[model samples]
Target: KQDSVVEDISAGCGVINFKVNRKLLVQEDVKFGLTSELFNTLKRGTTLVEYSSPNIAKKFHAGHLRSTIIGNFIANLKQSLGNNVIRMNYLGDWGMQFGLLGAGFGQFGCQEKLKQNPLQHLFEVYVQVNKEAEHNEDMKQAARDFFRQLEQHESEAVSLWQQFREITVDEYQHIYKRLGVHFDIYSGESFHQDQAQEVVQQLQSQGLLKTSEKGTGVVDLSPAGDMSSVCTVLRSDGTTLYITRDLAAAIDRKAKYHFDEMIYVTDKSQENHFHQLFHILLAMGHSWADRCKHVPFGLVRGMKTRSGEVVFLEDVLDEARARMLHNMSQSKTTKEMDNTEDTAEKVGISALIVQDFKGPLLSDYTFDWDRMLQAQGDTGVFLQYTHARLCRSVLLKITKLYLAGGVSIFALCDLYSYDEVLYQSAQDLQPKHLVNFLLKLCHLIASAHRELPVKGSSQVVAQVGRLILVDSLAFNIQLYTVPLCTKHKLI
Candidate 1:
């Protein structure tokens, strides 16, 4: 069986390879790109993604990096596949932690220091207060009193909390901009405190809320009606717990967004938490909880800067940019470019993302700056360098050909596989497949560039070169344009 599209079929080592016609491949790719019929085949609906979620007034640690990027990737993938995606950042802005922080601020906080460096001042205050409250009975009482005041909506406590929350959000926005991430909504546990009380009332009315021996409000999750599996929703002191606030948040979002699905991205430690959350929701008669998902990722170990153990996300970003700038200066092939700092930042961030995304999402891996930023091998630096070389070698030439009415063509073989990989990535919500696909494509383009001569070749051969260059460039732009590649600028 022979066809025009199949140029040759060969069998070797019990495997068969089909050589696809280059011209037909290009035509098909163009059709696929223009129509996007593949995505149309998949069901499309509104998707809500909740991620990042650093506690207000606390440092954005490296552990948060996984959730932030993974959530952004899911949002990007959903949108690309024709789903209406809503990115939400759920801040931990309430609970006993805030009580301690409030009391600490009242005792040791300085207005000038807070205004100058809000997070730093708050962190210092928190540390100092924790040390004092460990043994000081009076200090512990002050924290409880402050939280009680907050719950009662005392003007002074509420005012201070509002100020801290606003300042923290303002600072976080700048960092998120650097990472090329944004959210449609900024929700917090504070917003649901009152609603959480109402949820407790509902649970009690439904006879699902049980009082444990310690006077805490709990829900029994055991199969045999035993108190073996219990989830606490309230403290004995009559305060709402994390799961209580989460229940309120879920119901609120369902009413507001009416999304078809919702995903929560968090560390693997919270797997049971989400399981208990959805189970409780189902038991409370919210069947839509069945559509909810928890995307748990493993921890990142040994992520440090030259100063010491990294405490903030800003430190990580700065360290990556500085190291990348030093590497660029030492490279013999580095070109003079505008906004060199911006390029270094993008490349460095890409290195971090590629390293984290190369393996299974739930596998804990050690972070090594040297390995991720390597110029060769399966590193992001290699991917960026390959793409830049392709742009330098043939982008301008291809543009001229197109301007002169030359027929446009794309790559052979991989174009078909690219779509399949993308579809699977979206379906499974895994990024490793797409990352590997792009890396393999980069290797192929690099090989084609070395062997094919485009500058002084016949029109047909030049078009073949154009096919490889254009398709590779297109694929790179499509995948890298997302927040995954953060601030990527084409050469």
Candidate 2:
């Protein structure tokens, strides 16, 4: 009886024979494992994610791009799992780099250009000043003096630095909008400067801090009695280093948010830095330091735009949007939409993200735009294209089904096939699993749409069954894609 029922309603009058539970096909949350019971029992808590920590007055490079999207993905995943996630962009807004930039700005910086093109002008000034400082001791001294003034909170120095930070942040926020990323907090090394000194003092009081032969303050992190590894918290001149600032920031975040876990997303190059950081915190008697994690990713080579090698995050976003638009214009399958530009932007970004995420996070890969944006294959464009195709197919049939009342849409689908794939995708956080499943679902959907007679005077019950299937597919697809889009405010 079950076999006969499957054959009767299967696509193309028994060409695709499969069985499905009617109730399971209609209940999306159950199919996706996001039921209320699961949430009620899950142990969810606060999580702070720090990512895309771009340096102030510097280019928001491709490395930061990786951090931004990866962090966003992590944040989205944690939230979906019921965790209270805080998205943070820890800007590198302090240190000697600022001293160089400050001194350079005083010499070659223009108020007009700085106001007009803040990052570019500042980068140019930094480059120029760096070259001059290498040959001129006077220029070097000026950098030191300017940095000293900044540390001392001199009005003029602080005001200039503040302007640079504000302008750069404003620019980054706009660009992050294009990539669909946002931050709850924009904390930085500067925010921890005072706290860093206090941390040093605390370490001193606790007898954990010791002076090295070079006059720098070091913390012993070795497991053995002999010091195998030491973290340098203070330089010879009493200035706090990057790790010191990080320690202060971590402590501050824990105290303020009381986050159960904190994750730092950066490149693999800084793996050692984080190792030392967590070690120092543990040595300082902060047991909660073990909850901290550093999620390191690999590099991308040959990412460029028409102008040249990509420098700013804006360039990468623009390049993706522009290339996608061009591809859409050339493709016969491209649909006419009121917001084609916006669609292209989403699709383009989707392609870039999928391409990067297709491999293991720790493996470096050469980026190729053409490969990423291809219409067919395991590319992001393919995912977006499939989604768009499914949307059109379902919407057209849905209108017909609505007109044909009392139809049983849930009856026609082989829900077991799609349900298993969706379940597995959700369980495996790797996006490729979801991607491959989506591709298979799209294939099955395309075949069903072609074979199923939904257009002319179809049985109302059959139409309803098809509608149930399409709605289920839409729900599942959005379950994965919506988070990416929502991060960028696309939905």
Candidate 3:
């Protein structure tokens, strides 16, 4: 086997001479089956990933961005592994908040402003109404009245609410496009209102619902049957709470998709809420609730842009793009571009995603612009730069082997190390492992590009073998990276 392999040495254009042993194992020769084997063992069932459930008429905050990207990553990974994955964005488009928004819109909303920017106009109205309702009894009553009308589906209230929902969803679709995220099902609490009512009635019939002193409905989730823990289902005003709607949504999804598992992506603060939701579902005799899961992430604090504090998703993305654009403009190595803005956007978003993924999902971290956008270190900017360099180097019109003479080819290629890193990345849902792996790969490729001659080589077989190594490196980097960026629309 060793003699069967080809060996040669090459020197060209003052480039360093290197040799390839006959028995050397290039990256292509190393078989990595750990990740593939694990993936194949998965049950191959449908998975519904519910994430980024932002409320209608509200600014898209940092928490929503975390959920959005994290959910997209999970969905992408599941799909890559052959699961039937469904990405669901459950909007918070119901409850007393809508009542406040309705009354606020009635008081402060301008039709012209709404026509120009529906979401922004509605958000301003909501903020103003909230402030006024705090000190004015009349405003509070008006909000309640508006919400009551909505609950009753009064023609006027329903019309206004429908318009609000449509406009908000339309705006969200565009923003999601910018991020490369999409949803197969866009549902909300409003869609399950009737089902929520049905659930309450059913719980009452089963004697699982108890009326509290305040005229509220509660479900005892205690394992000892002592009612130590309770979950609220209905408010005193006979209005369904958020959990009730969630119950309806879960049951509805189970019936519709028949998914083997459902995952909810949200901040850690809502961990208890999900616990109650799943518990209540189980208590309600839904055996499938056992398969439901909540993947809670930590908070991202102090996120801002050049303008000011980050109040919306758009601001964060825009900040990223602007800063990246500035950096690219100043860099001597930056290639002249047709679409500088698009390149900036992709690179900027990559920086954010890499920063976010570098840490544990449950560990809160303060966002820093300088650190994340740095051209060096383990930042997203570095990742993108490295990938671009690898692509450029591989595409260069040259061919020369760069391995040191008499050196073990295994040490140079590090095929086993790459396999191990990839296996770890696949096992753990963190991107840091993969990020580190690609960083190291980039360093190796850079060394090879500097020392190897691709255009003119004395040894044809050695040149071809080294070119194969470069090609393998580029392919692996793209294989891991393209999915992440594409899933988030950052690419």
Candidate 4:
């Protein structure tokens, strides 16, 4: 007799039926305070969120995963509250790095290996080639020759690099989608190569350009021609430096999107790079330079597997899924589970995401499996199980009320459970939602850490009485209590 949709999200006067229209059965819009307001106040128009800019044909590292997930979360949060959030994949698709990567890829690359395991193959070839190129004169000379060829518009190398770039992007796009990510723009450094020269010309026109002894072009920010006040735009060999492309890319984004705000998510090391880039932009009279922000986070260490090596992102996700399914095998609810694959995928990602999100963004930490999988503590499993319990608990209470003189029953565990979930989501609450969340989470932690003494263990009558009392109290306590949270935890 049971089916998909719940009887009603809000109370209904009409008879409940499975075939009822969704619009008729539920509220058209959900209500929450300030979530809508905060998002709207941040942006005047569409906001650009640039993330996961891993090098084309390079392995997407753990740090890249952090930036991708965090940026997407920010974007989703903004969009949900009603803003035109534009997700952009700003790939590191140009510069001398690519010149090196392209050169290395060409001399020692394999098409069959690349097609089968593209990222691993690319990394393997690049690393071996780079190592050899470092000490061996011939390899270094060949790499330089190949890069020079690419610069000169040699059709073979350029075409090969383009193909590698295209294939890698396609592969990453699929992977990102699996992780619930999609980018509206796939802009690259290569896209701004032509535009970079125009930026250089503009800098020179503003008397911002200075020449170095090596005949390279740089910007003079200091009174003297020291390196501190200036950044190298064009290398001594006439090649563009990394910041050169970045400056140009910023200008390009401004021109194209005219974004009200643009955020760059990367590691904390890039603070200086971004500072210089933004300063140069503001100095160049781009008034919208203030709209740019760099949200840098700490390093993630010990992101490895049983093999005792740095794990690939794909491998880690596979492990998460496997571990989650193994956990599911022992779960009492799994036998009643409707969609095993979908549930496994969701729970696996939740496990991974909650680990990162459970801590502060600025604190460096090593990744661990045992810590993230805890069920009796403040883990995703705990949160999810609590949610499921709330569904059942609320139904139980309503049923009890109906049997008790067909009158109202007091709201108990449901409110506490609601507050717990709300706290995790950063919903507005009494006496500072964040503080309440931390307090409640602390209460839950205390309960978990506590040891209980059994009363009347030998007497059967007393044992049964104590069991009933404890069970009743547990139902009520679980309904109102929150979980443990640290001062550093954000959302």
User: Judged by TM-score, which candidate is best?
Assistant: 1
lDDT of 4 by residue, 1-491 (tens): 43343433443678443332333222322222235445445444677888888886566678888887777766664554355878898788765555567767767888899898787888888788878778888777777777777767789878977887888788788777667777888888877776787888898899888898779898776745566666788877766777888899888888888888788888888888998888899989987889888878779888876665663567777776677778888777665667766666656665566667655566677888777766656555665454444334333443222122211112112223342344344322111232234335544533532422233267654334433433343454343322212111111
Better of 1 and 3 by lDDT: 1
Candidate 2's residue-wise lDDT over 315-376, tens digit each? Answer: 78888999999999999977678898888888888888888777767778898999999988
- lDDT per residue, candidate 1, 193-266, as tens digits? 99999999999999999999999999999999799999999899888889999999999999999999999999
- Which candidate number would show the highest lDDT if scored against the true structure? 1
Please estimate how well model 3 matches the true structure, expressed as its whole-model Cα lDDT: 0.79
- RMSD (CA, Å), candidate 4 to true, equals 12.3
Backbone clashes in model 3, listed as residue pairs: 179-488, 179-489, 180-489, 398-454, 398-455, 399-453, 399-454, 399-455, 400-453, 400-454
Could you give the candidate ranking by lDDT, starting with the highest? 1, 3, 2, 4
Better of 1 and 3 by TM-score: 1
- Which residue runs of candidate 1 sit more than 4 Å off their true CA positions? 1-41, 397-399, 403-411, 456-476, 479-491
Lowest lDDT sum, 10 consecutive residues, model 2, at: 403-412
Worst 10 residues of 3 by lDDT: 403-412
lDDT of each: 0.82, 0.77, 0.79, 0.64
The worst-scoring run of ten residues by lDDT in candidate 1 lies at 400-409
